[model samples]
Target: MIAKLTDIEALEAKGFDAAYPQKSPWDILRHQAETRPDKVAIRYLVDASDPARDEVVTYGDFARRIMGAAKLFRGLGVTPNASVAILAQHTPSAQTAIWGAQIAGRACPINPMLKPDHIAGLLDAANAKVAVIMGVNGELDYWSALVPALREAGVTIPLLACDADAQSPGADGVFEEMIQTASGKDVQPEGDETALAAFYHTGGTTGAPKLVQHMRLNEAHVARSCAIMHDLTERDVVVNGFPLFHVAGAFVYGLSTLSAGGTLIVPGRLGMRNAAFMGSIWQQVERYGVTILGVVPTILASLKATPIDADISSLRWLLTGGSPLPTELADAVEKHTSVPVRNILGMTECAGAIAVEPVHGTRTPMSCGLRMPFSEVAVFGETEGDADPSKPLGPDETGIIALRGPNVAAGYSDPARNIGTFLDGGWLVSGDLGMIDNEGRLFVTGRKKDVIIRGAHNIDPQMIEDALLAHPDVLTAAAVGMPDAYAGELPVVFAEMRQGSQAGEAELIDFLRDRIEDPVALPKRIGTVDEMPLTPVGKIFKPTLRAEAIRWAVGQAAEALGVEAEIAVDEKLSTRVMVPGESVDAMKDRLAGMPIKLSVEARS
Candidate 1:
């Protein structure tokens, strides 16, 4: 195991090719199973409150289960080029399905929370030959609704259910029973390093999802890099509550810990969403002797609020990602838990990790640490849609970020979507705006599409968000652009207050007024919500906030024109405002300055 990473160059000196000899994820798992058969690979909590009920899987058993899963998929006609779609929570069976499908063919892990039609579209997009879904259980039930939707969508793939009731209908077979018929000894690894291993969908909530093709090499590269960067060892135990659908759960925390021969502790079926698990998470950490705790910003905030009733001295690092880690929140968490918070920069296209703050390195606020070894991360001048990688910007020059490395995915499944993102020369353009310092630390500003344009001036919503987050009463904050009649777009802030804080929007806006130095960046209005809308992976869902802002803007305009307006926002976030026939021209004139396809029509 790596002792520590003093510098990125020092880590790179140990040549990447020589350090990671494993060609695929299966190869790494096989090596571990052969070398340390008795070592615990996964410790699954059956109930967070009961330690004795935990189910443990040794490396030998885990490897065999993956092999069995592979054999099962292959027996069901899953070829090397076909895919095995998975729709389950963070359970042992789900883990098996993911790795096993990769070995036999390819794994397409879809979000179980998505609508049936969206799930069907993803299954169709991946060309899945078979699907394994979580069965109708007391805690979760997606089968009843999903089965008919797939049929309606004309998706006739075979369906298998895991953790299902014996009498559950609609499923062709049970995953556990079907796998028992297939012998693990007969399974063999298929595909080369460059072959496709998984199909991960991104951004399906708004429009058609883009399928990211992760090759075997990409997963292997990230596993090794993450293990080394996090200084993981067999002696360490990691608590990873992330879901399997996200790359952070599958690779960044899951495979990375196992690849290093460490024990991975998965929270119960509901994972972090389980209130009991989260309430007693500290006790569980102490019970498992967890050395590393992986969580998103939202979980971290919840942990900070939850009193530490148990001895958690074993935790060495609180690794957070999947969203911008507010410096204030990180500082608060570190102060409360006395554990250093290490930030990670990741994307699904890059197999989950682009950079990680070294466990032993100095903790720099707002910095995502050094780039991964053997990968090139550069910033370029922001163009219309794509940034030119040929001309890289200098240090401290804030611009668009681009990356190229073995960890990068081959490309999206839809080749047409690769024009701006997957460019020539193997460079994958990161839509995030960031800058590298002279010391090689990456500081991500925000997403390129997240910038709020105020006339000719470009305003970053992060500035407003950071200011609002500085308030002690604020629990979560997000900023978006509201359609403005004259300024094109104006900054608006949304906040979720801490429990029982009684913080009002006027008071929070007053607090931000003193903290914000730039006049243009100051929010025009502040709104409060019971809770912030978060993605399944726990990042703040900005699109929802943007849509709310547009609706609010249209309401204000209609009120001024003395006419009622009906606003409809489509999946693409295009707004259609229907008003009285007499006010159509006035409404169009009022909203003409906004940068959107504003369709103001007379109410039919």
Candidate 2:
């Protein structure tokens, strides 16, 4: 086994292909099955309420199941060029579908929480031959609602149900039954390093979804790199609650653990969404002797209130990503659990990893740690004349972060979407704004689009968020640009206070006055929410806040004109306000100076 990654340069010197010989995920699993067949590969909880109610799959059984899934898909007419779309929770069968589909064809795991039309769009985009959906299981009945919706959306592909119950209907076959009966003796992996392994949709709230094509080499390299970064081995047991559709679940936490022959314990069907599971997460860790705990920032934030009820000495590292890790939040988690929190920088285009804080390394204040082995991460100028990748900015110069490595995906499925991002020389231009420090650690500042433009000044919302998060009573904070008629846009903050903290918005605003450096960056207003809106993957949902900000701005503008305006924000976030014809001129005048385009309709 490769030594723990203390120095990235040393790992790169050994050469990526030479150090990690496993070319595909199947290769890794096959090696484990051959060497240690009886070792537990997966421990899936049947019910999150009771940790003891679980199912186990050994390495040998998992390998055979993967092969069986491949054979079953082949029997269903799946080809390497075609895809098997999966709309299910994280179950053993779902895991089988992911790996098996990859071996037989391509795996396309869709977010089951998405609307039917969106899911159908992804299916069409992937060129899917068959779909594996989660069957009815009590309150978790995605099969009951989704199957009909998919059919209504004109999805005619053959559907299979995983963990199907008697109440579940409309699927052509059962995933587990077919896999168990299929012959796995002669089935083999069909793809190679360059072959497409999966299609992961980018989580854009609007527009047509872009499917990132992960090559077999991309998955292999990332999984191996993550295993090395975390010092993962057969002894380690990771508890990964991330959904299958997300790269963090499949590659960062799921495959990385498997690649090292470690056991992966997945929470029940609801995964991290299961409130009962989250409440008893520490107990579950102790029950399973979980070593590596993977979570997003939102989950980390929520853990602050959850009392550690059991001995969690088994946990070595707490990994967080999918959003920026607030330094305060990291500090809080570390203090509470006595476990180091390692921040990760990843994206779907890179098969989940770009940079990961080494478990053995000292934690940097806000750094996402070193780049992946044999990968180049540089900060390029974002300006028009200086945006060339060849002219990367010097240390500490913040700009567009770009990556080039074997782990980077082979561009998006729609080639047109690759124009600005997938550039020449194998570089994937990440839209994120970041800086590589002198020590080679990466610090993501914010996204290019996330910058709030207040006339000529470009303000990063993170600066405001970081400032507000420093407050003791604030549990979560988000900064957004509130529409302003005079300044084009002004900074505003929304914060969720810790439980039992009576601190109000005015008190938080007063707290930020001294913390924020820039006068322009200081929030124009502060609002407190009982609970902050979060994405399924646990990132702060900024779009929802932005919509709320827009409504607040319209309300203020209409109030100035002495008119009641009804506001409507479409899926695209285009804001339209309607008022009486008499007040149209005054309302338009009030909102004229704002940069945001507003449709002011004069009601008859």
Worst 10 residues of 2 by lDDT: 449-458
* Cα lDDT tens digits for candidate 2, 422-489: 98988998778789887888997655547665532446687788878888988889988887654557
Give the CA lDDT, 0 to 100, for residue 491 in model 1. 88
Q: Give Cα distance to truth, residue 346, candidate 2, Å.
A: 0.4
Number of clashes recorded per candidate: 0, 0
Where in model 1 is the C-alpha error above 4 Å?
A: 1-6, 205-207, 451-604
* Residue clash pairs of candidate 2: none
User: Across residues 1-604, which tens digit of lDDT does each residue of candidate 1 receive?
Assistant: 3323346667678776677889799999999999999999999988788889898999999888888899999888888888999999888889999999998889999877666666787888888999999888877777877777777878788899997754457888999878767864566666579999999986432235578999999999998888988999999899888888888889999999999999999987888778888878888888889999998766776776778988999999999777656565677778889999998888888999988888878778778887888888999885545698767899999889889999999899989989888989999987888899987889886566566655323455776787788899888899888876546578899989888897777787788765654455678889988888998889898888888998999899889988999999875577899998999988876664454545889998
